[model samples]
Target: MVVFGKELYKIKSDRYKKARGGWSRIIKLHCVECGEYLFDYQKDGAGILKRLYFDRIFKELPKKPLKCKCGQLLGIPIIYKKEERPAIRLFSGVVKK
Candidate 1:
């Protein structure tokens, strides 16, 4: 696990390629309420992060409703209907890039 700031993240080393836009950047997700580091994410396209794919998360996360250490609600675990992939639906203004 790679330590960043005060948090530990298990970096994902496997490379993933998309038919469309490839992996763009790796961004550190932070808690909005406390500004604490949440996790590292491999974001594909630009713009707001509405959902976080499980495979893109670089750290192990708790099951079900994912929350920050400060108890602030971040996202809910769900299967994205369109892609049929497991992902976390992030709440608005709960997290920052």
Candidate 2:
């Protein structure tokens, strides 16, 4: 799927925080056709900052029945990955624990 302007902005902001030694917050979605995973970032605050930004675009997404490769409605899993680590260990370990 092609990402639009607003989606790109969200990704850039998430990357900037990671560059500044902040935790990376990932939001994962799945493709109904191929069972492929699409990973995005959660836009909430880093740790407890008193207030939080909880208005995520995904929250507005409508949950229509997902179609499988065989054209059947099947439920899929949405994973969230959020954590911090060294460069090599970033993708190595669990993002959420």
Best by lDDT, which number?
1
Off by over 4 Å in 1: 1-20
The residue-by-residue lDDT of candidate 2 on 28-54, one tens digit each, is: 444445555433435343552211122
Question: lDDT of all predictions, in order shown?
Answer: 0.79, 0.36
Error of 2 at 4 (Å): 12
lDDT of 2 at 75: 35
Query: Backbone clashes per model, in order?
Result: 0, 0
- Write the residue-wise lDDT of candidate 1 on 1-97 in tens digits: 6566666656554433353255456788899899998888877655688989898887777658998899998889999997788999999999887
Clash-forming residue pairs, model 2: none
Q: For model 1, where is the 10-residue window of minimal lDDT?
A: 11-20
Winning candidate number (TM-score): 1
